[model samples]
Target: MGALLILAPFVPWGEFLSASIKNPGKYQRQKVVIDNKPEYKAAAGKVVNVNDLQTFPPNSNWVISYPSSGDSTLDAADADTFTKYELIRLPAELGGDMKDASAFVAFNKVCVHLWCSPNYNPAEGHKQYECPCHGSAYRLPDGLATAGPAAIQPPPTNAMPILILTADNDGALNIEPPVWEVNRNGVLGMGRALYQDGKVNVYKEAG
Candidate 1:
């Protein structure tokens, strides 16, 4: 038999090798796209402003970059330990108002492929996410990678987790961690949700 075709995300390294080597034509391959939907209240999560993403709210589930360094051009490996952070909520305005459109940004803290951590490079046009290991690129605006070696095509499920956000009474915004991963069936794998008490919930984003 010939080699089997493998897709991405669900086509984990192990599965691809097995199918391609032993069981050719046993499994069909597909692609999964990262969902960069704006994290909002109910429908979809609102997007985080690029600037506001630098800071953290008073009280929320958002993970803040440790020892943040404002250097945008910083690479993933050189981003300093503090440059990477997870967010639960963000302020409507960086220091002014949410209407500025430059207040927040949304991105996956995880890699599109094996869920690895990505590196940031401002020199590459304010790059928010990139996998140094496989060259998978991700846009911070919505955690969507325009190009890279993720899967020849996008994953069937939300390759990149969606960061849904909401503002609290104190005008502070909060977001849940990612709770879904791609499965063998090319469908969204429900994981522990940030909003509820389930094993995996798609309502929240990941860390």
Candidate 2:
């Protein structure tokens, strides 16, 4: 039990963002609990019907926050305790041809260019995730920077970090805690540690 003592201070971070909370659009941290676990589960499994995803119409996004209980020092400030996920549904060509070929996809909401929340836009048949700060547009499903200054930026890792999801036998979708930084190969190792510690559980089997 002594080894488990280290897990105490490292509890799941953040509380649920209230509907009345100002700047709901702003980026912040929140606690994400596993489903039916007494605590909140962020927004995972919130979509009662996976098929209802299509009803959102194209170029729209469903934003949800999950507890990134692990340290995100490599991506954000060490004190910054949460990672937000931006959810959207697109065509098969965009979202990595998943198991069910589900068009639903999730991405780190922080824009690689200056970290503004990107919005969904579909005008003149051009669908893209557009960042408001500098007019950066990342191609949908894959979150690749196809247009905008982000494409020309020096960070070299322009694609937004993606969230990989797995569905349960009951059709509930769960987001796999990201363990690596996308496009940079830098590892977000803390995420996996938290899962193993039982401090976090993104899915039942993994918990």
Candidate 3:
């Protein structure tokens, strides 16, 4: 018998965005993007400049790299993490479900296939992120699998892991720790276990 196909019903952008915002664990405030070798640093209360991403233009993306040396389970060489996020400004008339013209969305840098980092490919006005390892393509704005083996059979999850983000008036964005890992049927799995109320914990960004 063929494998069962699971599909998640249409999920509004607002609903997914809101759940992440309301339940995200604590985040350390810092300037996510900066200049120099490290290119990022920890700060008490720093606001990120969203305008810095404008250089990539709408439909394009900026790759954010950060260090992650504290984890002992990870390989010794795996000392950094990456996330690709895009900012798009579409006219209301052409907008699908994205309510805001300036929409921001992000996903794990690791490709579900071989864990290779996917690169943004804005071709013919369509925004997509394609994996270099096996030519798998994930649709932008939602991170759904669109092509290649990653979208077909033999893959665990077609959709990419989404990072929930919330921004402040100053344009600084904070990431919620709990990641929503989408499955083949569009269902979600917890990237990490969550803590209950009254048990204090610090959610640190891997990058």
Question: Best candidate, TM-score-wise?
Answer: 2
Greater lDDT among 2 and 3 belongs to 2
**What lDDT score belongs to each candidate, Candidate 1 first?**
0.36, 0.45, 0.43
Report the C-alpha displacement of residue 9, candidate 2, in angstroms: 30
Once fitted onto the true fold, the runs of candidate 3 whose alpha carbons sit more than 4 angstroms away are: 1-31, 34-56, 66-102, 153-156, 180-207
**Local distance difference test, candidate 2:** 0.45
TM-score of 1: 0.41
Native-vs-model 1 lDDT?
0.36
Write one digit per residue (lDDT tens) for candidate 1, span 1-207. Answer: 112211343434344224323543332221111112233222122223323433322112222332223222232234332123344222332222352322334344555455556555544344345567666665544444556555334333234444344444443444332222332211221111122243333332223
Off by over 4 Å in 1: 1-102, 176-207
Give Cα distance to truth, residue 105, candidate 1, Å: 4.0
Candidate 2: tens digits of C-alpha lDDT, residues 1-207 = 433322312221222212113344342322222222212233332442343443333344555445543333222222231355555656545642343325566666666655567766756566778878667787765566777666554332456555566565655555653334222211121111112243332222211
Candidate 1 at 135: error in angstroms? 1.0
Candidates ranked by lDDT: 2, 3, 1
Which TM-score value belongs to model 3? 0.51
> Per-residue lDDT for 54 in model 2?
36
The 10 consecutive residues of candidate 1 with the worst lDDT sum are: 184-193
Candidate 3: clashing pairs of residues: 6-185
